[model samples]
Target: MLPNEFSSSPARVSGMDVGLRSHMQRIYNRMTVGVLITALVSFYIGHNEELLRVIFGTPLKWVVMLAPLAIVMFGFNPARMSSGALRLSFIALSVLYGVSFGAIFAVYTGESIAKAFFVATSMFAGISIFGYTTKKDLSAMGSFAVMGMIGVLVLSLINIFVASSLMSNVIAGVGILAFGGMTAWETQRMKEMYSSRDNEEMASRMSWAAALNLYISFIAMFQYVLHFMGQRN
Candidate 1:
């Protein structure tokens, strides 16, 4: 019996690993779709001068800018929401983000935007891979990063009125580091969260939640990277 149990252990462990990989893949696939949607929407709105002006140049810009945040804060309850509702919420958030980010085209040159995006993608991929593969626990680092992010958010809000270039640069520098840490932390957390026992709905909800976390981290990293690399028009 002892030999039989030992012989089966490897297969069980291998199955678990396969399940984890599949779960992570689903999370990544959802995130990729969200990123593509945001990119396409932003590109469309950015290229249209009249639409850009109508959205960003008018009082409606505030709504476009803050709607995603509002939805995230108030309506992103995956536990209570069905998978369909979660998907709709994710799409709406992505579209709102795209609308807000469309202003970047008016501010930064295309070459700089592309360069920053490439850098951000490379950094995110490397960091996430490390997190997924490393045996070390990053919960402490994640907590610290969350605190740093909150600080960054507060500073950013303050800088909106202060409008100091030095402070803005400082925020961007700190934000890049914070978001980079968050990418790794979130990846590790997602791996740990995966379980074969979860029902289909539960698994789907978890995937959406993980995707949202990674998506936010990636977008934040990209924006911070753009701040440093982007050439203003």
Candidate 2:
């Protein structure tokens, strides 16, 4: 007998797979659009030192530093919010990330950034596809990725005070691995969490959660990869 959550009716699994596929597609599409927006904005602002200084200088420094974290808070919230609200949160997060990445364009050569972005894109697509199709459970990787992320964050915070170049590189390297794992793990997670019976509110909230996680992972990985090839001003 099927579990209560899956329904015990004559349709068996019913349209659950169909609905899940559509939901997953939306999540990926939303995340991809957000990444594109962030990249465009970041690339645009990267070339303009005047605008960069305006946004990143003075009191704005605090805002620029904290904005990504703030957007993440809204994006990850699973409080049964509306789809529009969820989507807006994702967009807000993406914009803040783009603004933060603007600094990279100033520091890195355009060619290097382009090369690294392409590499990251290829890697992201491969792993994300694996996550979507693999029948194996990724909950273990998800747990470990979370721990890896926390470690990376702690190391990064320490580097700010230590200002050690060695530690910075180590953190960047680990960041690539951590976020890469997260992208795959989160994709698998979304597949696992999906439910056809979930109302629009539930689906929206969960879908955004998945999309937001993937977005942040991609951005983090892209930045770290760029560091290796960046032309350091």
Candidate 3:
């Protein structure tokens, strides 16, 4: 949120200005592509009754639900892989997420889902813009958001055993607020990670990493919002 605290030569500052813009654009572009892929994959699966039944009706659903988490833990490592590899893995992760998310359509109407998507997009854009433009430091908020997310995760797991709809709904609303804050924090962190001095490869890797964070935040926000709008048959 604060202005450039990193002291640098005038040439370096100029380079950073241009490089940061380009790098940010790359991150957004990668993230957008991933989101499109996810939407397309989700729609295709959700709209086809046979495809949906085949995946969700059997033991395969466990693999679908767990695959994304496994991939995120191992596949997203920025240290071992190249930028191009990470970008590809990022798209793969989105597809996995989409497969898991297909069940939403079975539970909610398409119109409600569309409405929630727009609401999420609007919220994400505004929150990310504030992160990019604000003067106040969001690191504190980020820490709080992380804590809130952990609390929500724990409660959600508990609810799975308790089977309490009221608690589930409350967690969903809290999750939306937590992820909104996380979106801002992640955007700020991604921007701060940029440096003109880095090599193109490093910059690209960082962009993919940022994209991953933003993508997760956006998806989480959308899921939480959808719970509120979703209607039961």
Q: Best TM-score goes to which candidate?
A: 1
- The lowest-lDDT stretch of 10 consecutive residues in candidate 3 is 1-10
Q: What is the C-alpha lDDT profile of model 2 across 41-68, one tens digit per residue?
A: 8988888889898988778867977977
TM-score of 2: 0.89
The alpha-carbon deviation from the true structure for residue 68 of candidate 3, after best TM-score superposition, in angstroms, is: 0.4
Q: Please, what are the lDDT tens digits per residue for candidate 3 over residues 46-104?
A: 88899898999999999999898888998898878898789789989999998988888
Q: Candidate 1 lDDT, tens digit per residue, 33-152?
A: 988899889988888899999998899999998899998888788889988898999999999999888988888999999999999999999999999999999998899889889989
Among residues 3 or more apart in sequence or in different chains, the pairs in candidate 1 whose N, CA or C atoms overlap within 3 Å are none
Q: Candidate 2 has which clashing residue pairs, if any?
A: none
Query: Could you arrange the candidates by TM-score from highest to lowest?
Result: 1, 3, 2
**lDDT-sorted candidate list, best first:** 1, 3, 2
C-alpha positional error of residue 168 in candidate 3 after TM-score superposition, expressed in Å: 1.0
Error of 3 at 21 (Å): 1.5
lDDT of 2 at 169: 91
Q: What TM-score against the true fold does each predicted structure earn?
A: 0.97, 0.89, 0.92
